[model samples]
Target: MADILTVNGGSPLVGDLEVRGAKNLVSKAMVAALLAEGPCRLRNVPEISDVKIVSGLLELHGVKIDSTDRDGELLLDPTNVEQAHVADIDAHAGSSRVPVLLCGPLLHRLGEAFIPDLGGCRIGERPINYHLDVLRQFGADVQKRPEGLRLTAPDGLKGTRIQLPYPSVGATEQVLLTAVRAQGVTELRNAAVEPEILDLIAVLQKMGAIISVETDRVIKIEGVDRLGGYDHRAIPDRIEAGSWACAALATRGDVYVRGAQQLAMMPFLNVFRKIGGDFDVDDEGIRFWHAGGTLNSLVLETDVHPGFMTDWQQPLVVALTQTTGLSIVHETVYENRLGFTEALGEMGAVVQLYRECLGGSPCRFGRANFRHSAVISGPTPLRGAEITVPDLRGGFSYLIAALAAEGQSKVHGIELIYRGYERFSEKLDALGADYQVG
Candidate 1:
């Protein structure tokens, strides 16, 4: 039998919830431990499936990891690290994009790496050409195979200059991980400087890696010969915080997200205020709610960093369904991110997808046939409908829609949500949401 979530709607979700470390950073940080010469301690780690996936992958390579779920602490030791069988990697990785990240650290440690066919949320075409190209620039040989890809550093990986077509977070991470312990200094142009990326840099620096960020998407890494372990408490998950903030607006409730930092969330907060959603920022957290009076709509665009994030677009789109006017969201990050709107449409949201960029400057995908833009018309009454969870962020958006709808919603494939969200059902329960799982 398939697992499902049944949500009874029309009630506001109001309560206090704590957000742990960022899903984006924590997994990469776990991968970073492989580069350490000794054990690394990571704190505030969220209990998400991605963490489990990375932990499993690390163990397969002979890294010893100990964790305490209650305290969210992880101790990863790389002293006995060794290569595992290719079949084992394929089995453990299973549809996760993390194996691609294992490439750099594995090459540095074992002088070789193997990556299986990668899979992630089918939200867009996330080609790893950028990653592979960066590895090749670092003097790693790439070979394609029936299973996936194999990489070897015959010349003992040397650093080189690289320029990314776009500031992709994953690709930038690839460069950082590979270049940190290389033979020479490396310069990366057009690199992503997201908060999560900065946090990962902090982790690397704590491990004795020398890295610097210059203006206009430039990052420099001075290769180090020997590195030690790091102790770090990851940055709070701003994406989770923003998702709950949108949930509050959609359900006309109030939610206080503990551990939510104001700096990382400033862009989202400014947009939330523009939409007539109210928020107060304090040291501990941020409190978000739907302000009385009709909600307003505005044009928004998703950009690399210091702009509205692509992950933030979905939940806010659910809130836009309750706004008084039309809202245009131009998603420049991932091409197919707007596809989740089809379910929103089924739930009575009038959202239309557009192939051309809508209300913002044309992006890289503008010439392509991808439907990367969305027009949402609001104040429409949502009715519960059976929905399938697509990806992590999209799944949570579906939950928000269900909570704001007039009746019950049956959500299947919700296990996909566990890859990022930590104890989501428990959080929903704490918020007084009517939901059941089986």
Candidate 2:
């Protein structure tokens, strides 16, 4: 049976919620522990299902995971890392594509890595072609079988220069994780410089991997002989922090998000303030609220770091439903992202999806037949409705929509939301959100 969230709308989600390490970074960081020569310690980890998924995957590969005395900390000992059984890996893989990342690190240690067929959310087609291509460049032989893929480094992995057509985060991480222990220098052009990626680099650096980032999105890595485990705290989840801020704006409530860093969220903060929302940033975190006025409609675009994040678009779109005039959002990251707006339209929001890129710039999806842009006409009052969650980010947006709606909303498939948001139900309860799980 699908888990349904019954949300009583019209009440503002108020009060304080704490965010932990990033969902994007923590999982990949856990995967990186496999490359370590010694025990590793990661701090500020979030208690999300992805962490558990990665933890189980690591244990299957014989990495010992233990808890530390400090809260939100994990000790990963990869000293006895071994190849996991194919059947065992397939059973414990869950729905994350993180196992694909095991190719590089496992190859370095065990000389061969077995990758199960990857799975993720239904947001868009995230082909592992980029990852496979990167692995091939590193001299790993890829063999496709009925079960999954088997990658063996017969001549040992070696680094080579490659340029990404697009700066895909997964692809970039694949290169980093693989290239760190490869035999030679690796130069990657058009690399993704997201904060999560940088934090992973920081972890890798502490593990004795030498990586340098150029201003023009080029990253150079000098392959190390071996990598020691790192003692590092993962970055805060900017996506989660921004989602809560948007929830505050959508419900016209005040929210103080602890552990939300200001520097990483500057683009979101700028956009929030521009929409007539208010925020105050301190050493601890940020407080978000409506500015007690009609929210202004604005044209926004989602890009890589230093621009509005694609993950931040969905929830903010919910807030735009209450804004005056029209708001245009161009989603450049994922082509199928605007598909989530249909649920909003059902709830009385005037959100229209367009194949043409509606923001100031034309994106890769402009020529393709995908609805990558959305035009929102609002000050439209939302009514109660039943909505099924599409993906992680989109699922959170549904909750924000339900909270902002006039009556009640039955949100089905809420289990997907737990893949990203940490302690979300309890956080909603702390904010006085009227929601119950069934």
Best lDDT among the predictions, by candidate number: 1
Ten residues in sequence with the least summed lDDT for candidate 2: 357-366
> Worst ten-residue run, lDDT, model 1?
356-365
Candidate 1 steric clashes: 0
Q: lDDT per residue, candidate 2, 359-399, as tens digits?
A: 66547888889988889998999999999999999999999
Q: What is the lDDT of residue 180 in candidate 1?
A: 96
Query: Whose TM-score is greatest here?
Result: 1
lDDT of each: 0.93, 0.92
lDDT of 1 by residue, 1-438 (tens): 237999999999899999999999999999999999988999999989889998999999999999855479999999988998999999977758999998999999999999998878999989999999999999999999998899999999898999999999999999999999999999999999999999999999999999999999999999999889999999999999999999999999999999999999989999999999999988899999988889998999998789899999999999999999899999998989999999999999999899998956648889899999999998899999999999989999999999999999999998988888899988998999998897
Off by over 4 Å in 2: 68-70
TM per model? 0.99, 0.98
Candidate 1 clashing pairs, residues 3+ apart or interchain: none
> Superposing every Cα of model 2 onto the true structure, what RMSD results?
1.3
